[model samples]
Target: MRKTKKKNKIYFPDPKFNDSLVTRFVNHLMKNGKKNIAYKIFYNAMKKIDLIKEKEDKTALEIWKEGLKNVMPHVEVRSRRMGGSNIQVPIPISSNSKITKAMKLLISCAFIRNEKTMSNKLAFEIWDAFKEQGEAVKRKENIHKMAEANKAFSHFRF
Candidate 1:
């Protein structure tokens, strides 16, 4: 690699939750340089989740974390070129990468939800993920299944 690896920047936790993960989520959710708007949308979604899942004893943040975990992929397949052929090689994912992938899948799936508002869509997706039955969760499951199916090509992993 030509460039040195960039040092990871430290992110201070958000005001309400005092959690760095929440800040990271909000950062991913941010668009057009509007972080406050992203925070508002996330906080509103959390409030909606609280109201919708009232029977659950856990806080909204806990639910959100659980949802993220549910969508985290343990293994993924990558394209590898070997012996004049391309192969799908299964590989284990690092913990940090799993979290990043889960967050990205959740955000992308939530964006496609058919809801009146972004907050409502995100809240609904989060609730579904917490139940282990959402598009994002399914996507993760599919990724793992594909990796398992391609286990014979694991030797091709670069």
Candidate 2:
């Protein structure tokens, strides 16, 4: 019962890519308020992608975008009370939330990758995602499967 909705904060585009999305991704990647370190890691990962990319037609940033898109989930499941019973309801996600979730998943999967450095791990994760074969992609697929399984309960969406 709030009187007003919270406003979204504005983020300036990153220095290297001039993309607000990149800024948002770095914000998600950031730890302990060390934005400079996060930016360094992200930029380094982009450089690694540039060195190892297979598709010459697309840039590193483009590959990252595609990978993120691949990880974005269209629907998600939530618990809802219906007829004195809890039901898993499938709900459509908004575009902004989809992007946020995708970024978080990508970063988290990158952290779990077996690599020498954060940059290397992130670069490999991005490449794997771009190829549609990575933990992030798998997580997205799992979410889709859950949503599909609970399609009958979609009527309970709030």
What TM-score does prediction 1 earn? 0.94
The digit string of per-residue lDDT tens for model 1 on 19-129 reads: 999998998999999999999999999999999996899999999999999999999899988889988999999887888899999999999999999999999999999
* Prediction-by-prediction clash tally: 0, 0
Reference-based TM-score of each model: 0.94, 0.95
Model 2, span 47-80: residue lDDT tens: 9999998756899999999999999999999998
Candidate 1 — worst ten consecutive residues by lDDT sum? 2-11
Where does model 2 exceed 4 Å of error? 1-3
How many angstroms is residue 5 displaced in model 2 relative to the true structure, after the best TM-score fit?
Answer: 2.9
Q: Which stretches of candidate 1 lie over 4 Å from their true place?
A: 1-6
Candidate with the greatest TM-score versus the true structure: 2
What's the CA error at residue 117 for candidate 2, in Å? 0.5
Q: Candidate 1, after superposition: displacement of residue 114 in Å?
A: 0.5
